[model samples]
Target: MNDSLQVIPLRHVDAERMMELISALVSSAGSGQAQGGNNQLKVIADTSSDRLLVKGSPEMIAKVQEMVNQLDTTPTRRLSGLRVFRLKYASAGHIADMLRGLLANQSINSAGATSTLESASLNDASSTGAAINNAASDSLGSSAAAVSTSSTSGTSTGVGGRPFSIIADETQNAVIVNAAPELMFEIEDAVNQLDSRRAQVLIQAAIVEVSGDDATQLGVQWALGNANSGYGVVNFNNVGASATTLAAAALAGTSTAGISAAASSIAGALIGIGDSRKDSQGNTEFYGAILQALDSSTSANLLSMPSILTLDNEKASILVGQNVPFVTGSFTTSGNNSNNPFQTIDRQDIGINLNVIPHIGDNGTVRLEVSQEVSSVVPGSTGNASGLITNKSLINTTILADDQQTIALGGLMRDNTTTRQQKVPGLGNVPIIGRLFRSDNDSTQKSNLIIFLQPTILRDGGAVASVTERKFNQMRVLQLVIDKNGTIKQLPLSGTEGWSGNVSADYELMPLNPLIPKRDQAPKSTSQGFTRVDSPNSGITTYPLNR
Candidate 1:
């Protein structure tokens, strides 16, 4: 075996795949030379630098070097400077369209124009035009030879008296630009700017049922919460209590600024809401903490906590329910042999659906268009026989709020009433006394629906990582029941300490948004709702959420 090593640099061939083939051959060579001695060849590939490191006998090393040269064949290249730009975030089709528009809008210089970075030439366009005309003429003529077409389409005249063509590859999200070298430089720059990652928004939506005194406290503005009204909220943007009620138009979603004038009305009455308002201990707190305190009681019933992540200016939708099938229309087909009834059944989702499109503003605020609908299938109604009877509450509103600030939506009210009667079997036939044998009962119930929305802007990777870690810690605790509630043991996740379920009390409450302000630490709280509870690092238990 040779004591020294040999280096083989490759250009055209891929180092990783070549290494696999070489390794197999080296193993075979070692097996063949087992009786002789340790002639084992070691092949190491450095994919980054496209080089191979090998240590073997002189004869084996020379043979391997020869194989490398033979396989590393130089491929042909295009005479034209054509390039394909792979985009990470932007759509290739959209970018190509934008480039075409830009190039088309470019003004041509009449005074013996020398093609510059931003400018293109009209003279260069004639060449591409001639090519197109030639292809057309060839196809029209009677010839045996095939008339080939160019993939490049002349979007507009480009730099250096040449016409450039842009083609978008949707499957690979890449844009292929064929143009003069000068124009290619400018095109690359534009693509780089557009291909960068856009900002993302994390929307957390909580739907709760408000009742008791809480419902009364939220009056007109509360109802306006679900639907957009002429009036906005009174206590807007989680600020301290103020007198004049702000109109909903104040935060109406628009490209420009919101309405400054608002008619005076008392909107916010409930106290201790918003992140700006501190708790009893004077610690910065999230309004969700106050809601959690109410969640334990019948005052507030948390219907759902649905969250989604979406790109800026992109729409995100969430549907938390089931699809129900109902007959839409039916037709009977008559034939001499047999008759059959055909029914057209359509399925509709009966649950909570919240759609939101968030636009991240430069001023640390987010404009959102929220469309929320909550519906259920009604029972024992006239429409229920043929089609499904549905009770639905839908609201579509556009509003602007501060970053990480909770937007309150309420005002949807529902009333349910029921009457039941119990009667005797046979003895109840005795006229007036029969009434005494039967018992009657009546009941009426009312509930209000309120939605809370909070949007967090993720500007970079750090913010994403922080949120990821926070969510991981907040996962529900798991328990291992070796049997049916017998010999139970707690399960623990690897890499994570025994701590489970006490996700981030402060992290969840504090703003994770980098664009907005946040608290240094979570406010001190006596309520165990936000308080951290020490639990053994038991195994994870996946339990089905109760309906």
Candidate 2:
């Protein structure tokens, strides 16, 4: 009748097992009195909170406490919960595949205390099979991640002992893993590291056309500077090279070599090739060399400025031109003898194009695979024209440089000559005697294509925010200048109060600034802390329990 109730919270051991063990001990240690069964120690397992409610005499409760203390160590049981890791930047499927490759060779020890593997064999990942419960798959909270049943073999894999399974929830953008708790922590750590936001690269480029004389000047300026690495190579591409073929060749560490690069009427001759960077001595070069040389009599003109922003290890491209239709093929059907010919028309893009793929290094260096082209339809080329006259300038190369470094590509030139003679109508037909009244004019001009490129890296969210804010504010300023409304100057651009020196969850789904529209994305209260999530997007969203 005189028993005390003790509530004990557990971290490792399951509450049910703990109670069973203590019940036996209490029964044998209790005094042999004529008390009813109700007098015995009552131990109830609280699996909901992983706690134990124990009622017994003071002495019995003391024993139970001692036993609980002895058993409450870190659990080594080789069973991991179905843990879901929501990814931010990295793809969930990619991360899951990487982890599976890492854990493919893991084996169970003789004692079965832990999962052991020196290294995982990637070859086995494709062939390995696993078994997951259908109920567990169907019960997965996120509808985006519908679980696989027992028939789904590759979702879980094991050589022996308890199987380890990993599934990628593409809709949820999450990686779900079921493994030992000890192994789970290691996998979770890797997920956290891999799921981080990727760095971004912004590339700026300018294409210029200069006279042949200025091209020589630029070539000299480009070659004169001593490279810090002291390693350099020059490449020349053949005329009329396709963009796809040129890029493939460059990626394979080779060049298009079927035809020799002779006097190209289509693509101009290459004038200069070199890296252009600011020197410690502060000598104005690069653009200065091109413009100053053009300032004299070189007749240099900037054609276009193309800029693109992209993630690391990704490709960015910009193209400015017109699409001209050309006949690719002509077909005649035998069934129709009506002299009717069917023609296939293809639209060819003719203009300036710049494409680059950037691979970032940890040392603030970037390796760029660049492909540039300038193509134009000759003065009077039309649809379905045969052997149409076209001009083109193409360059494909890879360069490695420090972040925010500039490089110059030039020397592509085209040559054209014109001869005009004006003569008296009847007198010009008089052969030799007409020469006295006839005037002859002959002129030749040369144009060289020059390209300058610069790549900059944005390492963190703060850096991204700063760059984005600059662009946003620039537009805002432009808007203010054009607006005639009285509130133009008073319009608030102060929505950036979210960003700080340290950016953690600084970017939100809905704008904090009152100017932008806000959605009702806040979580609704439920019996389960956050059992229901109402988000249109697949990415992770944070919700406070109190709300």
Candidate 3:
């Protein structure tokens, strides 16, 4: 057999179905011609572009082509036309129901065939009954035809047709119909008549005070009900960190340079928190981490510290302080044997350093790392020599959160401010009998800083509206009142005698208000209680305020 390659182009057929058909043909041919071997025939289908390539002996290629031709010639139902229409704000189920109602009893002509209206009607009734029964059975989970009939009789008022199929494509937000050309036109008309106007989705965000007298100063209040849209809000709090011991170790016989170097390293780590890149929301992973760490604290002692204010001339620093030991030695010249003074060493200063780094994830998760170091000098037992004590703590973690969701990082407790009052500079230092000339006052303000982060995911109006409507229905009426005016008021009703009391009095006996016109000049009252009056000179129409 001579080797040959052939390409077959197919149209009006799904590539997937074509591939399956070819596979079946190959299997059958292979069984009949076992001598050809399993690999004798090779077929490649480029489903991406919908084409089939065959490589084999000429005999095999010809056999494949014959099968394709036969398959192509087989008769099948042909769609006269197709119409695709979007349901917009409508659901697929609703469009399906509408189509069922509009297209019921419509005649469907098969390919190269026709049907009379009478026959179509008869078929429609049977098909309608079957469809209703099927729907009822599926919904009710009952097999009894009588049950289905009774359940559907009230709801299934329209006839059904077998000539067309309605397909709801939810992903595409559209409905597609396959029917005769005339039927397609009718479907299009019916769909156009359905309401497709989409409602607006409104998303709102605010930082609200959950509690405290200062709550009013915090979040912005909004009336979302009056607007015909949906709404959402996100609340976030400040970020904070707690002071925790990072490391505790004694440093003896270690050079001062070595201790200083370690302190510098720890400081670098803490200050490096600012190196993280900010996300679209202008938040860095470091900040997020800090917020998370602060939030995870279970004890008040582990809370974050309040922020400090620095004067313009002074620079703010995260490296709080580092204390180094001082050493001195002296010789005594006048004592017996001209001996040196007793050698002694004293160490008392402590050192502390803190560092925090936060990393933000793409999915709004935050990873935080915190490093702290503390050091102190301990006196040696033998002489004036001193040893160093150091402590360090490090934390790293990740947390997941979305918009309107709050993540607590940490808390801080400290004296936020100090106030000092003194008399005139010269008199402030007076003592004893001079006490009357001087006065002094000192005060410390303590505060706790908590970090709260709330993220709000902004979405398209459609989605926002849908969510807002479904979740905030109760607010709608309230919003209307809010929109009318910033406040709600109750006004006294006029002409309430009949409503307040059981008796109705004649107008002739009732006292007239000086502000109102006389009864004869007033507009005639209609049965509906509205009085329309016309001015002959001004040609202006007026109505009485009181019904």
Assess candidate 1 and give its TM-score to the true structure. Answer: 0.46
- Provide TM-scores for the models: 0.46, 0.48, 0.27
Per-residue error for 189 in candidate 1, Å, reads 2.9
Model 3 shows how many backbone clashes? Answer: 40
lDDT of 2 by residue, 35-150 (tens): 66545666899976679998877776777788899887665543435677888889765676566545553223433221322212223343322222221211112232222224
Q: Which stretches of candidate 1 lie over 4 Å from their true place?
A: 1-81, 106-162, 170-173, 210-302, 331-337, 379-383, 414-442, 476-547
RMSD to the native, candidate 2? Answer: 23.2
Poorest stretch of ten by lDDT in candidate 1 = 288-297
Candidate 3, residues 64-182, lDDT tens digits: the string is: 78877676532343444556676766665456545543454322332211121111111332222112211111111223212212232323211222244555564566765665443
lDDT score, candidate 1, position 146: 24
Give candidate 3 misplaced runs (Cα > 4 Å). Answer: 14-16, 29-40, 57-59, 70-414, 424-428, 453-547
Worst-scoring 10-residue span by lDDT in model 3: 214-223
Number of clashing pairs per prediction, in order? 19, 14, 40
